[model samples]
Target: MNSLSRQLKQQFSILGAFVVSFWTIEILDIAIFSSYLDRFGIIPHNLIGLRGILFAPFLHGGIGHLIANTIPFLVLGWFVMLQETSDFFLVTLITMIVGGLGVWVFGAPGSVHIGASILIFGYLGFLLFRGFFQKNLPSIMLSVIVFFLYGGLIWGILPGLGPFISWQGHLFGFIGGILAARWLSSK
Candidate 1:
């Protein structure tokens, strides 16, 4: 196969693996652990809670939470890696750190933040801003498409949108995604 085809294959495979891992972990958490794993999620401002930064995205409160996150995680993540598959991992890293930290610092004192919404918002921010940073037609077109498709999700960042929703995660995730896009485009 040609190099581009190989890259596409690799990209899809990576995306599939990530999505699968999310499902697999959720299944195990629900079926085996009875959601005990969710305790590992981000607990704002607690010293031990810092560890959630590495585990929260992978752990969901329930099947509903995991299902809710699955589609966007797959689609947006696929699009983010369209040009450079490596960006998926980098964006994930930055989103988790920034979003997790933001939630930990700003989220309700006793609340534990979980779910992949942070990465979803991060992908939204990345796609929206990548075009501006890259300054190219294809990127611009991609940005427009992403905006039209997922713009409604922007409301997720607003405070008091939902008692269960982590607006802090969404807000910080967007910031992290912008940071990733800026950092990547600059380099």
Candidate 2:
């Protein structure tokens, strides 16, 4: 294979490994929660409790929900991680913590929404901004394409989309990602 193809393959392999690991953990969390559904609740009445952080990303309402989130998680994750593995992890970790905190802080009592979109949006925002600043043609093109494709995501971040989905969490995660990316780039 040519050099470019070889590099692409290697990068994809790395992304695949990351996705597999994330998927495995998610599945395990689902299995554990399914077996103990009575014990876990989506709402966070307590302040900054353990469940506030751990449970949101792990728990899904159903199989459809899980499937809906998986592709975006993998694709956006690959994009974000491809630039720099360390940045990928940092963005994801901060997104999750900040997103969850946003929900806990602003969400209605008994409100809960769980998915990877927030982190995905954050990563996308970071990539787009980075690409713009760096003046990298390919990255800039990719960001434009993604923005056009998933532009509707902005609406999902707003409240009143659904009773169950925590748009607040999504909004916070996205904002956190944008802020983080900007901060990272400035340094």
TM-score to true structure, per model: 0.96, 0.77
Give the C-alpha miss distance for residue 66 in model 1, angstroms: 1.0
Regions of candidate 1 where Cα sits further than 4 Å from its true position: none
- Residue 25, model 2, lDDT: 52
Q: Give model 2's clash tally.
A: 0
Kindly list the per-residue Cα lDDT of model 1 for residues 1-187, writing each as its tens digit.
6998999889888878878988999999889999898889999989888899889888887889889999999899998998888999999999899999999999999899999889999999999999999999999999999999998999999999888889999999999999999999999
Indicate which candidate wins on lDDT: 1
| lDDT, residue 159, candidate 1 | 100
Tens-digit lDDT track of model 2 for 109-177: 755556556676676666656666656687678678768866677687778987766787778878777
Q: Candidate 1 overall Cα lDDT vs. reference?
A: 0.92
Query: Best TM-score goes to which candidate?
Result: 1
In model 2, the Cα lDDT at residue 114 comes to 62
Ten consecutive residues with minimal summed lDDT in candidate 2?
A: 35-44
